[model samples]
Target: MILHIDMDAFYASIEQRDHPEYRGKPVIVGGGNGRGVVSAASYEAREYGVHSAMPGRRAGQLCPHGIFVKGRHSHYAAVGRQVREIFSRYTPLVQPLSLDEAFLDVSGTLRLFGDAETIGRRIKAEIAEELELPASVGVAPRKFIAKIASDIDKPNGFVVVREDEIHSFLDPLPVERVWGVGKVGARRLHQLGFRTIADIRRYDESLLKSKLGAWGAHLWRLANGIDEREVIPDRNAKQISHERTFSEDQSDFEFLHSVVCFLCEQTAMRLRRHGRKAKSVGLKYRREDFRTFSKSKVLETPTDETAVIIRVATELLATMRQTEPRPVRLIGVSLSALVGADAPTQMSLFDDPGYVQAERRVDRVMDQLADRLGDSRIYRAGSHDWRKRPRE
Candidate 1:
């Protein structure tokens, strides 16, 4: 059986767990102003129409009593490690999709663990008892169904879909419950008289395929409870990134430049944190009209250096202006073509021999300082103050 484990409102839940005053209150983790967007909102806030990715001002209007807090990504990373350690105890075939969610293939471990549902209960119990965190577990025979089942009932839910019951369990569920059926897809499916998975199952797959293209056949199989995807372990990331959406469009190049620097630093930090380096830097920006542009540059050497990342990202953003001056609603940086930190580099003979070493030292110091102090608390304004030695 496959097991999917998803934490309940991970960021906001962490905030509530750390701060006693935030418990039962609508906790929001992000800036609650026009300059920011919501990162996560507690279940309490969801009742008031607040959600992640929503504008902070709208979240505030929806839940006026919301308790807004800055996200401590370091804390979240630490907790994620703890959660991962718990998953490791059960099975080695674990694939983490994010810090708060993962898929575990327990087919081999079932013999030692009794059964799939038993293992799921034990795992959920351990998380709640040991870490005081609520986790929803879904155990099924397929990967996609397991993910969907885990989310079916959340915030301390456990659901087991037996092999014999997969069809019945899926039949009456709305067509929207199928993965990849977003707003537009759902509306189209509804217009085709597909209110439920059963309706989809009744339709001819070829007819549906002709109408929806290749995706229609995929949806038809899903409706009939057929998912062949495996839970492959060690699905290491191909890239690391960070992005931000503004409450209001930002037109100023100076301001956008600062945002790019911040995003580069954030992405580079994450790259290093994983003991990886990127050989390519990618930039993405969405205009006020919702049009998006993306560009990337491959580097001569893989690096997790903040300076190099920022320089390349800034250059990519500058290329967008050639089209026309446009206000940006969102901006992001991505680091790809990841390689191990120990990967050998052929440093330029023309460049200083100590250049790479100096850059690593600076990034290490900054990483430590950011962990000790908040990420936003420190900034490099063209100075070496961070390199100064303390009293002996």
Candidate 2:
């Protein structure tokens, strides 16, 4: 069976776990700025309509007494590593969806671990006991149902769906319960008198296809509890990126440019950490009105160089700013189309032959420093003014 594990309000939970006084209080983790968005909120905060991705300004209005905290990505990454280690002890076939959620294929380990339900319960208890973190576990014969089952109870939930009971468990649920059926899909399904999965299952395949296009058949089958997907052991990352939201809208080009340089360096360093390089660089920005857009440029060669990524990102930012010259609330940089860091470098006549080697040596030293003192402790020359000042 496939077991899906989701850590409850992971970032907020971590904050509460680390700080005993924060427990049972409405706690939030994110940018800690008026313009910032909530990355995660504790269950207490959720009762007041505060949630992840909500505006920090709104979160405060909803839960005025809530404790807001800045996210410590380095600390969270360390805890995530520990969580992965716990999963490894149970099964090698584990796929991490994020720092807080994963899928474990226990089909082969039943003899060693008992039934799927037993394994799921044991994992939930183990994570809670060993790490002092609550986890929800969902077990099913297929990946999709298991994922859905995990969130049903939530905050230290364990749900098991045997093969024959899949339909009963899913039929009465809303179409939105299906993973791929988002707001748009759910609206369309509702329009078709398909409020429930059971209602969706009653539709003819041809009619579903005619109404919903290519995804119709897939949705219909999923509604009827037919998911033929396997639990893959790895969640491959396609891009590396970083962004920061400001406490106030920023229209100044020079200051935003400096932020872009810092974001580029951070992303490039992360790419190098994975022994990867990116062939394309992109920029994203959100206006105070919340409208966001992005643009990208393909490079002639893959690179993990901060200067190259920043240059491309700055060019893209200029293009975006020209189209929408509003005060920006947030800015981000991303690198995609990745290759190995050791991918062949095509030397150009304009380049000094020793330059690439020199950059690598510098990166090696920086990596060591970052490993010992965290990424925020070090910065490039261009990424100044940010260390001491908050986004506002």
Candidate 3:
């Protein structure tokens, strides 16, 4: 069986656990300023309609007494490692979706560990006992259903869907419950008189394919509980990327540029940590209407330098902007075509050795400072100011 485990309010819960006085109070992480977006919200704060990715200004209006805290990405990453270690104890066939959630296939270990339900319960209990954090778990024969089951009842929820109970469990749920069905996609589905998963299941697959192209057929299959995806373990890292969806659509050139710069910085940090360099860098742009575009640049030299990546990324972004200066809802940066850091460099004789060495030294120092303090404490100048400024 497949098991999906997700931490409950990971960032805010960590803040509350570390700060004794903040327990049971409304706690919101990130969104320290008007322009900032919330990273996470505790259940206490969620009662007032606060949530992640909501604009800080709106969150403040909703939860007037909400306690706002800056996010410490480095600290959170450390805690996430501990959580994964607990998962590793149970099974090696584990796949992490993010820092706060993962999937584990226990088919091999079921004979030794008991059924999927028992293993899920024990893992959940271990996390609570060891980390003092709440986790919701879901077990099913398929990946999509398992993920959906985990989220059905959150904040310490546990759900199990037997092979025979998949349809009964999924039928009544809203169309949005299906993965990749965002607000825009949901609205489109609803407009077509499809309000629930069952509605999609009852529709003609050929018609769906004709109307929505490949996505329609994809949704139809998922609605019928036909997901065949496996839990893929990240044993060998292939690509590194980071993306952000804003609380509101952003159009300002400078703000969006800063966002790219920040993402490139994060992507580069991971690349260096993995002892890798990239031969290609790419950018993903999603408009407010949910249309997406991508651009990539091939580099002559593979280097894990934030400056080089962002320079290539900005040029790509400018080209995309020229094509269509539409409001953006999401932006991302990625580095691929990875090679080991020890790989020989193909540098021109005119290339300055002094400058290259200086850049590497700077990256090492920044990474060290980030580890010693937190990612929130250290950042390049290009990304510092716009994160907190109100959109004009």
Q: Tell me how many residue pairs clash in candidate 1.
A: 0
Q: Alpha-carbon error at 184 in model 1, in Å?
A: 3.0
The C-alpha TM-scores of every prediction are 0.70, 0.70, 0.83
Clashing pairs in 2: none
For candidate 3, lDDT tens digit of each residue in 1-392?
A: 99999999999999999998999999999777664678899999999999986888889999989999988777888999999999988889898887899999999898898999999999999999999999999999999999999999999999999999999998999999998777667877888899999999989999988877767888999999999888877545567889877757788888889999899898998888778999999999877656678999988989798888888998998999999899997899999899989877787688798887888788899998876555556788888655555431
Residue-level lDDT for 16 in candidate 2? 94
lDDT per residue as tens, model 1, 291-365: 568899999989888988888888888887666468877788999998999987767677676876898798999
- Root-mean-square deviation of Cα positions for candidate 2 versus the true structure, in angstroms: 7.0
Off by over 4 Å in 1: 33-35, 235-272, 277-339, 347-392
Model 3, runs deviating above 4 Å? 30-38, 53-61, 67-74, 244-256, 286-293, 320-331, 348-350, 369-378, 381-386, 389-392
| Winner by TM-score | 3
Q: Give lDDT per model, in order.
A: 0.82, 0.82, 0.87
Error of 3 at 319 (Å): 3.8
- Report the Cα lDDT for residue 259, model 1: 78
Per-residue CA lDDT of model 2 for 1-392, tens digit only, reads: 89999999998899999999999999988636665567789999899998876777888888888899987766887888888898887788887766789999987888998988988888888888988998998999888899999999988888889989988999989999998665545666787888988888888988988876657888888888888876665324577778887766799887888889888888887788778988989898866544567889999888887767877888888888898898987789988888887899787778776887787787788877775555655778777755435321
